[model samples]
Target: MAITIKHHIPGRVRFSLAVLKQYRDLEDWIKQSLIAIQGIKQVRVNSHAGSIAIEYDAQILTEETIKQRVAALDFEQGEAKETEHQYTRGDVAMNAIGTLAAVLLPSRWGAMTTATLIAPTLIEGVNELKDKRLSVEVLDAIAVGLSAWRGDYSTAMMTQSLISFGEYMEQRTSRNSDQLLAELMQPAETMVWKLNDNQSVQVHSSSLIEGDLIELKPGDAIPIDGTIIKGAALINQSALTGENVPVRREEDAVIYSGTSVHEGNILVRVDKVGSEATTAKIAQLIYDSLSSKSEIQQVTQDMANRRVKITLGIGAAVFALTQDVNRLASVFLVDYSCALKLSTPVTFKSIMYRAAQNGILLKGGSAIEKLGQIDTCVFDKTGTLTYGDMQVTDVVPLDGTNDARGLLAIAASVEEHSNHPLSQAIVNAAQDNQLPHIAHGEVEYIIAHGLKSTLNQHCLNMGSRHFLEEHENVDFSPFEAEIKALEQQGRHLIFIAHQKRLIGMIGLRDQLREDVVDTLSQLRASGIKQLIMISGDSQYKAQMLGDELALDKVYAQATPESKSRIIEQLKQAGHKVMFVGDGVNDAPALTQADVGIAMQNGTELARQAADVVLLKDQLYAVAEARTLANIAMKLINSNIKLTEYINSGIMLAAALGWLTPATSALLHNGTTIGILARSLAAKHAK
Candidate 1:
């Protein structure tokens, strides 16, 4: 096979192979082979696109070496190497045709036809026995083989047909569910404009590197985290911060990947690129999580294995008691492996699909199971509970130089040039009130302190109170009582000065999300025993918000490390904790909690560590996930009971000769199919 290099960076490369489009079956074989090679960390093959993305250790194997290895691979050899044990629809259809032919043919021909149809099952059973395992395959083989040995050709063919069809359905359901999740988790590849030799060049995002200058125009998604070096734009950070409105980003402003440019254009110097980008890391985490099994899956698998042994033991007992091959054949037909092993994961996958449709991405079955059991829900204050965007709430003209609207207009006119959150809030407030702009001299931005300019031949300053009162020698003692009152209300005050005198102040605060109260109430109603909040804010502000939300506990002034400690403490106290957060600082806590849910606008690190990531900017998604998980668990348990009880009843009836081999096979397979249907339908339940 010839491979074409699609793109390459330091540690990652993508290749296109036209042969893969024709031979779709080669996808898994190629992926498996590439992943087994040294230094290859991950391989994603898209046969439809004829493309493969490989993330490797660049130090160990260069991109050139990987391409050479790919080119050396033989598709013919790979096709022969791929061996699948599961039955396909064509296999089941052929078996059904064979059963029909056995019944229509003469007795001698029917016996031969039955023997041929049952050969594969018998061989699989022998292989399992050689491997020292009494699997369901072995049970199936014994039942069909005994029926054939007893000269019951029709019964044997029918039994083989039922088993093959059941296996086909089970495999098909599992495969489809997995494919749905894969489609949902796959991230779209992006192309960006890189500045080359002072000219704009379009290239794959994978080819980008740190310090490369990338240009983003209106409606373009920022592909790499970087600092804006030129131009300006209204960037929508809703995907990262859950703020519905777009904010302006100017020169020297830091911009993160995953956010999009709502308007304007800017040149960003890439700080993180390729696999190091937050979105890329998150994509890797999601792929890794797909294969993880939950505790319920493990338990059901163990139960299925144990039941296979029990079925074999019962078959032996029935044969020894009456030396009746017919009874033994019927007894072996009722093994409880198919339903038990397949239904739990099907249910989990179904629920995961439901969660995804509702804007929640459940990483794996383990996340669903753990989320269902969480008793304590802990929330981070800033981005999780609040909108994470400051808005102007009060505008007090302290010196009577301007009314509220006039003070806001003066502040907005100067702050409009800045990209700070507070300045944006003031500008937005002024825009909302249709305030007229007040022209001023060239505004001097003093880094972290404030802004300075000449307004009407007088000095104007806007920044923190310390920047005015201490740095500029402005008098704020006269407004001490009024400032204290606003401070007590948990508002951030921005001091505005004219001619070196305190003129007015703007009080801004990050407002709580509109759905937060309803979300918290739903959490409490859904069996969350303790609703707690952790914040980096002062104790007073934290407690006030906690009280308003009726939370059980509040931990204020929490550091990143302290946040993890709190989760550890709650877990040690016998509570299953679930932490909801969206900042890079919340990564440790997200990892420490029993279940970590990242909001839609969460930082990449937070999303990488979280078990569940909400794709919508809604706090109620937490409660919705919990509800879905609870329903999934209930469905799984019921299916397990249905499988065990129904299979046991069928086996008893077969042992007592109340049912023939054909009838026993029909009932057992029907029960398995019914249980599987119930499991797959979990998304629709409640």
Candidate 2:
């Protein structure tokens, strides 16, 4: 297994800077490497002047290829003589200054080099978008600019621009913050493993770190990775593991350093320090997640455009009213979207992490956003809704064989080790009947089909209708009508046979979820327009379940891809849809929907793919989220209205000579805080 990098898919670019061994030595080499690809397998890695860079096409050059090429370089073999360049502090600062100069131009004015300097910065400070006072795009630009500004100031190149000592200090601090996050985001370290036939790992950590024997108090950051030497506590690791509530950790429970201690205090032995800590990776993921685009990217894009126009229009109107461009420029400092933008993604991620604590995994922000807009939910039933658990309900013997149990018994013995939930159920059912299970049979596993196995030298097979037909044995046309009658009532038919002889048929009924009917009704009552059921079960059983749940639409016998297609179909027809599923089988549909929701106890894949994960598997969680969203949007709209009313009224007063430009500037900035506070009121509403 190799991880495929999907960096060049239009809107995305993947870039990395090398982690220099003697990082302090070569700043210029790092800067030069930034312009091109940095070859790999480097051990005694020396840095460039300041940063390492990669060419755009490097994504196409897989890591494996680079590893091969870098291995061949043999840096020490040639007594390797290569020219090393040197630069003074002023030279480095001047070069960086030149780069930032070109990058200052707006998106429409720059070239590729400008993008290299600015793009990463834009990605870094994307959270500023939450400041509604500014446009999302303007925020992005400012973020990029701030980074460039910091870089220039750090190298002492910003002296020309900073007219005062105060400005220089501000520029320096901003640079420090930028560099801090960048240094902390070094690529994840990989570990090699050796295992015997047993699946368990002998030891987990590779190295040990010594720290002051500090007792971790409740609500404290772990500070180091360690095994539980003493004590226990419920750890609320929303910051690290994304769990809403704290998870309980007892003695002998290994606690990763950096995850917070939510409640109880404990003694832990430090295992790893610094970068190797789990908290570091969590922080990196948080940063990357903020940088990446969510599903409703339109909100940010539109906000960005609106800010630019609002600023332009406001600047003119303010100039006419107060006759002071300087005061007008001060209005530009208010970014009202900061709280809104940053909180949305952060809140969504927190929800995902909470879901993980409840045993669900939602892939990313995009999926979470999609889950919020859902109206019509589509589901893949067998594994998703139904527990995918099966049990033999009936045994129908055919072809004059009075021994149907014998064949089922033989088949179940061989399939005991199969991973399918259904197979496990069958084996358990056979054992319950005290049926003799003969082992030592060769079994063949088939995808999308039933398995074939030899029992006591007699060929036996079991699976779906198509698989049975392929074997050309077990011709059950005579009993087909009876089977259809049974299936109409929600019974599943599994054919068991021995080469050309129909031995018996096993009927299984997957138990319905205890709360499914109530869940569906609650969602519909919450204003969900359509409840569509997607299942691989027979049409008869599918319709039966739909009727039981009062679902408006039902798609029976669908594959995973088909579930996603159904979601797209509803969206195309102009309805917002939310899909609720509980297993990996529903991952595709979860990703495809407007809002994908998972039950509290859903599979990791389904949870990760969903936008909102239901904490308790109750449909009410969906209702809670819908109501929350409704209120959030309302607050957002109200904030805008208040801002507009205040600005327009203030401008009128300024124009009539009642207010000075300086006074207008102060009031305009002051009212922003008040408006935001009033907007926050809706956050607590029902």
Per-candidate total of colliding backbone pairs: 1, 51
| lDDT of each candidate versus the true structure | 0.79, 0.52
The C-alpha stretches of model 1 lying farther than 4 A from their native spots are 1-86, 109-117, 187-212, 215-287, 395-480, 490-506
User: For model 2, how does the per-residue alpha-carbon lDDT over 1-686 read when each residue is reduced to its tens digit?
Assistant: 12233333322333323433234443332222221222221112234422222232333345444333333322222222232223234443543564465547443333444444445335433543555444533543552353334342221112111212222222233223223223322222222111224221223223324542335543344545667766787764444455544689988787764355545556666665543344333333434443456644446445635655665565567667777634344443333343233333433434444333443334445654554456776655664566656777877776665576766676677566444566767888888888986664556655345677775577878777767876445677777787787787688777777775667777888877676776666666656777788887778788998887777888987766778888888889999877777654566687777778776545443444566655454444555555455444444455555655666676556545565433544455456445544433332333
Q: Candidates' TM-scores?
A: 0.71, 0.54
Q: How far out, in Å, is residue 360 in model 2?
A: 6.4
Q: Which digits, one per residue and each the tens of the lDDT, describe model 1 over residues 3-35? A: 889999999999999888776677556654565
Task: Please name the candidate that would achieve the greatest TM-score relative to the true structure.
Answer: 1
List the lowest-lDDT window of 10 residues for candidate 2.
155-164
Candidate 1 yields a Cα-based lDDT of 0.79
RMSD value for candidate 1: 9.5
* Full-model lDDT, candidate 2: 0.52
